[model samples]
Target: MFLAWNEITRSKLRYALIISVMFLISYLVFFLTGLAYGLAQDNRTAVDKWQADGIVLSDESNTNINMSMIPLKSLDDVTAKEKAALGQTAAVIQLDKKGAEKVNASFFGINKDEFLMPDIVEGRAFDTDDETVVNNSLKEENGFKLGDTIKLAGNEKKLKIVGFTENAKFNVAPVLYVSINTFQEIRFEKVDTTENARINAVVVRAKEGAMKNVDLAGNDLKSYGIQTFINKLPGYNAQVLTFGFMIGFLIVIAAIVIGIFIYVLTMQKATIFGIMKAQGISGKYISISVIVQTFVLAVLGISLGLLGTVGTSFVLPTAVPFQSNWLFFLAIGGAMLVIAVLGALFSVRTIVKIDPLKAIG
Candidate 1:
């Protein structure tokens, strides 16, 4: 340890450059993870925020939320079987903010007093059919002010934006919460009968053995657990799989590069190590020093990488979905450290095998 510390301290600039490499790669890993997580949240934040166990939908819809339409008659049976409520009508919001200005959004038609309704971060929750609560991103994207009246571009239905909620989105777009009354009106275009207000799905709360089975009106409707439902969200799997592969590749590539770098450095010091072994200084001693050096480099690098990520967060705007999950960061950092340590081990055999005669020459 002392020998390793002595050399590293003596050649600060050389090790600093090496440490910088580790730092940059680690920062990329962490940043990409955050970006991937943010994109996923954009797809399902609204659904995730709902404290429901499962989602009920029409089986014939083939897991497509937009295609699924549950009949109102099944509501009583579903409610009796488990706690439940209605929500549907995902749409693009084309309010008349300016000529031809439109915001991509998920328009959720939900009961005013249900778990699906997220708490208001600004203004107040929707109370009547005429009011709608939107995600915070809308304030910037469309210049939406609280209590401002805007009309849906294609539907011609005017409603007031009364509140803004945080972390509510669907399919990478902002979420707009409205009354089931308004949902039916916008979706159907006519307010003739209750049957016209058919919804896409029921957000339900249930546990194993919680209720008796309830039929979803013929063979067209069924329910799924929350995680299964989330996995089926559009682009959710592809995005996650792609990013996961990127992160995995980075860690592995970094390990090989770092291991090779450390091994080359060890080979260059063959003469010194050879002399030390010849003088009974022990290959084990020098090998231990090399391990110590690798450990120091990893710790210093990961620390700086984490600090850099946190600083980047401050400079980014709220419009960017960069969520700082400390646990995730720690896990990534830990993996980097482990890979680095394993990389360091590749030099041990080289150190032990140094030829004293060749080194002396």
Candidate 2:
């Protein structure tokens, strides 16, 4: 430890430059991961908030909310402790306020009186067909306020914003929570509440594994775990996989670059290594010193990267979709440490091969 520490202290400027590069790479990977996660979340954050076990859809719907159509009575087929009959559609809202304009949003038809309702961040849940709740993002994205009247596209209905919520989004758009009847009216342009009423799907409260048994063959129904169903959302899974692969490749490249860096440094110190061996230092000790130095450099790089991420968050524009997940960061850091160690292996091998008799001859 002393040898490694002393070497790093003596060549502080050289090590600092390498650490700076690592910091920038780490920050890039982390920030991009957050952005990818945020985009994926925007597709299903509303559903995630339900905390439901699974979803039951008509076989023909192919796991898509907008494509599914189930009879209202299908809700009764779900043998669960709790559930909600939900519906959704894409619609545009025209904000008449000075600083606001028309924005595309998703309309989610949910029972406010039921457990499926989202956590209200401000104000209260909607109690009538004329009232609606909006996602928290809309407050900033569209300059919305409580009691502001929003005109629904393709319909004459004007709903007053009653509340705001977090994690309420669908298909990459913010959600507008309304009564099931209001949703039916907006989606189907009807007032019928029962007798041949159709809904997209039924959210169930049983364990995810148990949802498959919730078959309503009489209605030609199928079910899937919450996460399983989310993956089927349009373009959601594909986007996640694409970003994951890209980030993974970048990390691998960093490993190769680290290997090259250590290889060059070790070659330059070949004579020094031979002299140390001639002075009675064991190869294993030298290897340990190299490992310690590599670890120190890795830690410094990762720490600076984390700090850079935090700093970037403050000045980042609100429109940029990005959210930090601790688990992802931890995973990245662990992978980096492992790679850094592996990168130093070439140097260790070179050190072990140095001949004591060749020095000072």
Candidate 3:
């Protein structure tokens, strides 16, 4: 530690440049991670809030909740501790009578009396067919508020926003929640009846063992665990994989860059290493100092980068999806530290190979 500190203090500029590079890389990694996580969460935040064990969708829908159609009668065939019918559709809403600004949104039909109903963050849940509860983004980003009437692009039936819910997004769009009956009317353009009523899926809370036994084959439906269902959402898996590959490649690049930096620095100090060895210093001690210096640099760089990421999140535009997971940050930082130490170790070979007699001459 003493040797490492003394060397760093003697050559502050040389080490500062390395730390700056590390800081930028770490910042990018953290920022991209937050964006990836946020976009993914936007795709399924509403579903995650269900905290259910599994979901039942029509077999032909290919695990896509948006494409699935299950007759209301099929609900009876699903065996679970509890279950609720869910209806889904995509629509456009007009913020004003002039229709100058329209926004795409996902419509979720849920029974307020059922477990799928989200807790309202502001105002109260809908009480009438014309009243609706919507994601808070509309209020925060689109100037929507309680008592504001939301007009559908082509439909004459206007919905009045009665409440706002946080973290209620689906497929990256804000969700507008309505009663199952109202949803049936908006989507089907007709009142639900005994023979024609249908829902997209059945969300259930059941034990893992029970989920295995709850078969819907007779009803022409298939069940999936919650995570499996989330993975099947349109574009969800693809986006996650794309970001994963990018972040992974960045990590590798970081390791390579740090290794190269250490290698070059070690080569430059080869004579110094030899002289130290001639003075009776052990190669092991010098190698340990190199590792300690790398660790110190990584810690400082990662800390600054994390702080910058957090600061950026606060000033980012509302449209940019971003979410922070400290645990994820910690994991990434820890991995970087280990990789950096390994990189330093790789450069230590140069120090070990330094000849005391040649260095002194």
Candidate 4:
């Protein structure tokens, strides 16, 4: 280990370069992983908050929530089963002060008293027919305040922003909570008359002992012209899988790069190793030195990489999706350790092959 440290210290420039490369690669992997997680979370944030066991959509609409529509009658039919909170949800377009046409916003219309309403960060949940709640992030972005009015979908009547909530987003859009009647009014364009337009989907909460067979009941819902209840909200599994694959690939690539660099470095020192072997130094000592070098590089590179990730996260814009779950960081750390060990092992083969007699001659 001392000899290995001396060699690294002597070749400061080479070691620095290799460590820099490793640091960059690790940082890239960590940053990309965060981005992927943030994107998927933003895409499904609204649905996740519902905490519903199942969602009912139109059978003809396939899995696309935007195309799915369930009339009030259909929602009633499904809710009649038990433990279902039938509500309306959709994405609506509104404009910010910049007049940028079409800022997507999630519209959730439920009974004010439903348990699914997100916890409020400021103000309160909407109780009156005309009042609505908007996410604090969205409210801050648009410079909205309590009692402010915002038009929805070019509707002549503007909805009052009565409250602000935290961490509510849908399909990457900030969320707004309104009365089911108001949601139906804005979406269907009829406040006084029922024009046959209903909710896009119905959120259902299953009761205990109400049959644990969600798949069977979901299939049954299809018979009513309503799409089967999506057991898990759409896109969640796919999004997670996609991100997982990306992060996995990145880690593999980083490992490969580090292994190749370490192998080449070890090969360059083969003659020196042979000389050391001839001087009564055991092969075990040489091998241990190589392992020590690997550990040192791995620790230094990973520490720098983590620092870079943290610094980048701090300066990243809010619009840019980035999140760090500590579990993910720990998992990445474990993976890095395993890969670094594997990389070090690659140098062992070269060390074992050193010919003491040939080098001494």
Candidate 5:
């Protein structure tokens, strides 16, 4: 350890450059990982909060909640620990009647009494058809406030912001919670009293031991567990896969880079290793020192990288979906360290083959 550290202190600029490379690479990996996690959570945060065991949708809807249309009477045929009817549609809402600023939002028509209704972080839940609760992001990012009236761009339906809920988003859009009746009027332009009145799907909380039985093929509906539904969210799988590959490749590249640098440094000090061996110093000692040096460099580089990432996250605006998960950072950092150690092992061969007489001459 002393030999490794002493050499580093002696050649401060050389080691600093190598450490800088690791730091930048690690920082990029960590930042991308945060983005990937944030985007995935944005797609399903509201649904995850439901803690529902399963969701029932028409098979004809191709597993899409927005496309599914099941008759309200179908709820009677379903059995579970608890079930709630859900209606969903996408909309662009204007902050004012003049249509100056607009935001994309998902409208979720739910009964205030149902488990699907999220607890309000501020204000109160909607009590009337004209009142709606929105995700707290609206207040932070769009300057929405309690009692602000929101105007639906195309249908001219105006909704009052009654409350704000945290972590309520779907498909990267904020969710608007309104009564089922209001949703029907917005979706169909008129409420129907016929026997065929329909809703998007039924969300269920099944008994602990009955998840496997949640599917209802006989009732012409299909069931999906909360995780399965999340995986099926539009573009969710694709985004996750893309980020996974990128992160994986970056780690591999980091390993190779560390290996090359350490190997080059070891080759430069070959004559020094030979002279030490000629003086009766063991090859194992020199080999161990090389590994120790690599370890020290890796730790310093990764630590600085993580610090940079944290600093960047703090300055980022709320509008940017950046979430910090220490667990992920630690895992990635640990992987980089391990691979760096393994990378240093390649230099052991050079140390082992050093001939004392040739190096001294």
Candidate 6:
């Protein structure tokens, strides 16, 4: 063990090269994992915040919330089932500010009275019909503040920014909250300059056991051209599964690369190992030394890789959609360590097979 450590310390250039390779590979794995997680969260953050048991869309539109429209009359029909209420009105609004870039923002029209608006960071929630809340991410990017008026969709309607909230993005765009009336106006436009269009979907919250039965009411909304309840929002499950697969592939690749590198390094030192065996040094000692060296390298590489990932995350813009959960980090770290140790063990077989007589010749 002492000799192995001394050899590593003396061959600074060689060890440094190996560590650098490990570092690069590990960093790539972590960065890919972070990016995959970030994208999945970005794709579903808005729907996840709804905390609704189910969503109702138009049958003709399939599961697409954007294309689905439910009349205001349907709200009562859905709420009659149980604890359900009209969820937030949602839309995609394109904003064009004078002398500034055109930005696409998610418009969520929530009943301010329902306490469904995202937690406020600055200012207050809407107090009037024309008031709206913008995400802090939007506020910072556009330099807007409370009481500021912003033009939407070719300056057709100017909406007031009443408040700023955190983590209220939808469909990868920052969210802005307004009254349902406003959202309807923005969405359908006034037909004949008087009547507003219907809403896109009715977000329903069900009473306990409502999901168990799988029927909202005796009306059979699905048969009536209204799409029945979807327990989870569309696109959510698929997005998560895709990201999980990507992260899993990256970790596996890292393990294989590290394992192969360590195994080859150990093989190269077979002659030296045999000489040590001839000097009465046990194979067990050589194997332990190799395993310890692998562990040290794995730890160093993963630690540095994590540091790099965190540093990169800090500079990443919120728009980039990067999320990091601690459990993922720990899981990846543990897996890397274990795989590296296994690779070291593969090389240890050569130590046991070393012929002491061959070393003297």
Using lDDT as the measure, the top candidate is: 5
Residue-by-residue lDDT tens digits, candidate 6, 73-134: 55555542332223233443434345765667777765666535567789888887567888
| Order of models, best lDDT first | 5, 3, 2, 1, 4, 6
lDDT of 2 by residue, 291-330 (tens): 8888888888888898888788778877778888889988
Candidate 5 lDDT, tens digit per residue, 1-361?
A: 9999999999999999999999999999999999998988899998988889889999887778988998877887778889998989999987765635789999999999989999998999999999999999999998899999998867868899989999999999999999988898889877766778788999999988366766464657888887888888899999999998999899889988988999999999888999999999999999999999999999999999999999999999998888998999999999999998999989998899889999888
lDDT of 1 at 211: 27
lDDT of 6: 0.67
Better of 2 and 5 by lDDT: 5
Q: What's the lDDT for candidate 1?
A: 0.80
Query: Which regions in candidate 3 have their CA more than 4 angstroms from the true location?
Result: 208-210, 213-217
Off by over 4 Å in 1: 79-82, 94-100, 208-218
CA displacement after TM-score superposition, residue 348 of candidate 1 (Å): 0.7
Q: What residue pairs are clashing in model 2?
A: none
Model 4 lDDT tens row, 25-75: 888878878888888778766666766556666777655666776665565
Tell how far residue 361 is off in model 1, in angstroms.
Answer: 1.7
Tell me the number of clashing residue pairs for each predicted model.
Answer: 1, 0, 0, 4, 0, 0
Tens-place lDDT digits, model 1, residues 240-293 = 999999998998876777777788889888888998888988888988899899
lDDT of 1 at 40: 86
lDDT of each: 0.80, 0.84, 0.89, 0.72, 0.90, 0.67
